[model samples]
Target: MIISIIHLLSSCQDFLDEKPSTDLVVPDNLEDIQALLDNEYIMNRNSDMGEVASDDYFISKQEWESWNEITRNAHVWADIISPTGRFVSWNALYEQVFYANVALEQLDDIVPDSNEQVDWDRLRGSALFYRSSAFYNLLRIFTMPYHLVNPELGIPLKLSADVNKLVKRSSIEDSYAQVIGDLEAALDLLPSRATIATRPSKQAVYGLLARVYLSMGDYQKVLDYTSLALELGNELMDYANLEQGNTFGFKRLNEEMVYCSYFSSGSIGYSSDTFILSEIYESYAAGDLRKSLFFTQAYQDGHVKFRGTYMGNLYLFDGIATDELLLNRAEAAVRLGNEEQALEDLNYLLEHRFEAGKFEPIAGISGEVLLERILEERRKELVFRGLRWEDLRRFSGSQYEKTVTRDLDGEIYTLEPGSPKYAYPIPMDELQLNDMKQNPR
Candidate 1:
């Protein structure tokens, strides 16, 4: 039954029209349920729009002109229209939600004996984690920032595997509440650590909780979750020890990875013509090793390209990691008036990124200055990790508000803080099939 389901899911090219859940035989066993969730290609991949719309990198005018209309529109913060009428990110993420719902529904009826209890708990926990992660990713791209007093409509919350069951878009507040509730529920069900990085463990849950809360600007919860996650394992890879010139500077699922996931690859993000912004590349100080380790001069004109992703390939690493947790802890601590702890975590992480002996600690700072330092380091350290867009959205109207702009052929396109376009429009096909409201362009 599971094999048939896999075959059906893989063979379907259009997820929105011919849904994978249609006329499927449900798998009843625990192994089959785990297999459904373990399809990382389907479950672990997330939206790439965050990276494509981010300000970290830019493509040459010639290259941008030749790209698809959807990619070009996304890069310039314009209303996106898919020429092919397919939205891979939206379809792929909801497919993950469907698989998770299948696992959760199956677990409800299966009662486990003493020997099967652990596996039962793990499977249930994994399902909840995956669902929560997918919802958060969808919210980041399709919905407005959580800190907004009155956010726009969020993506539809499909809690059932029935493709015939239509779900409406939930309120932004309700959407976030669902994600937090699911993660909180899974806290006790997951083990302290998973056998592999791809599976959800207690540490991964904590890390993801911190990320979600950070997006919502709940600083206290961010601090608590980051603290809890670091307690499990807080190892940071030393940049000085890596082969800076190697094609793949970081190994896949390296020591810093708390959870393993990748963003869907897009030409805007992975193209050879995509070059890192000069401002960002030049910001790394003389002793900083990340400059060489994270980028390469891909053009004769001194234009640099990002290559330091932990995925060890063109795909962006969108998973939670210890370095991000430390930065989250630092920012949250300072926001909550724990400057001492904030500085400690920030400087500790930076020490590993610079030349071993020449590393100087960031000290004697507090208030907004300390906060900005942490945020700056975050931009430098987590480059091309499918996070900058989330940060930009959450920072809207704050002291760190940024106005992103793109220049093409002597014309400029700018996206201002708190703009409605921050919430991208729903895919045309989705809007046609469902009654959900589209975000105002």
Candidate 2:
């Protein structure tokens, strides 16, 4: 994570620390730059605050108190004393931003011969993907929904390799626009798909654009991007084929995963939820593959625990996959009143997710009722992939409005649909040091 200064490593100085003085070695060649982007810990980790703030899981009374002050406050929708604290997640993302900046600024200097041109393009394209991805994640926690975003309240837009550049916030529109540009650039540079899921590909680029445009409330564009992405990659994981008794059934770089990344927000992660949210757990029909493939009974008290993360064992996943694109494309199809198209996409996804003989095709439903059913399936299918929080916000104030409330101990903490509290505060340390504007509490 890029802290006070972005250091291009030599040995082990941990430049991501808020206060660190380390020698900054500029990576001059494609090999050095590719190696930097491949440092998974520094380049790939995202702040877990979005997951913590989201309604997918809950913490126990004991667990809540055990968390640090910053996390505890965030969990309850309260303001923290220091914004730069771990839970706010500003620095960690910027660390990735900084690394990408270095790559973009320096990689062009290395002139590859005909043989290494493809490698060169892939390395640079990966950097653009990483930077855009980091910025998008930052926007999720630090700003209000697109409809409510004020120009002055956008997160800092860091675009250069210069470490001493003054910090400033871009308008929300400009921030999203920048991400779109970066992603499009990546799409042009990358292959149709990477050999491994750790790297970005043209498919991942299109999928992320679908997600970004969806968040910005552009359903048609979501469909447009989804169409392109699906052409490149649309392989869904078949739960029926998965081994029944494995502790973690999925593997990294699975056929369905277009991109793979993980983030840890302290102890509460993929395997940490002792109790699956009842509504989500019960939504599964008896024959639904997700019911058995995605969950298990806890060893301690027999409470339901989630063991199946698409990112494989031991990590909270926030990556792109074909299944997510299907949901978005279906939702767009329904919105556009293309009933046949919508049902075709929905049934295709559902057929693969249920027992072979028990699967039922949704038929005859139309208009709003059909849309609602599809949305509900989306909510059930995409849980714990770090998407429910955005879904809650997106549905709020519309026909599908939902109010999420968390009960911890005796007090009730609620996040009303379309509430200002949904946008978390930017870390105070960043505000002070960068002269940055803070989001309304």
Task: Give lDDT: candidate 1, residue 24.
Answer: 58
Q: Tell me the number of clashing residue pairs for each predicted model.
A: 0, 4
lDDT of model 1, residue 281: 94
Could you say which candidate leads in lDDT?
1
Model 2 local distance difference test score: 0.79
Q: Distance (Å) between predicted and true CA of 6, model 2? A: 20
lDDT per residue as tens, model 1, 1-441: 559757766665544455555555676888898888898878888888878887888777888888778778888987665656577778888888988998999999899889999999999999999999999999998887887634548779999988778888988888998999999999999999888899999999999999999998889999999999999999999888887767868889899998999975557545768888988999999989988888885564889888888988777888989999999999999999999999999989999999979888888889999988898999999988889999999999887889998888777999898888788777888877887777877
Error of 1 at 348 (Å): 1.0
- Taking all chains together, each candidate's TM-score versus the true structure is 0.94, 0.92
Where does the lowest 10-residue lDDT sum fall in candidate 2? 4-13
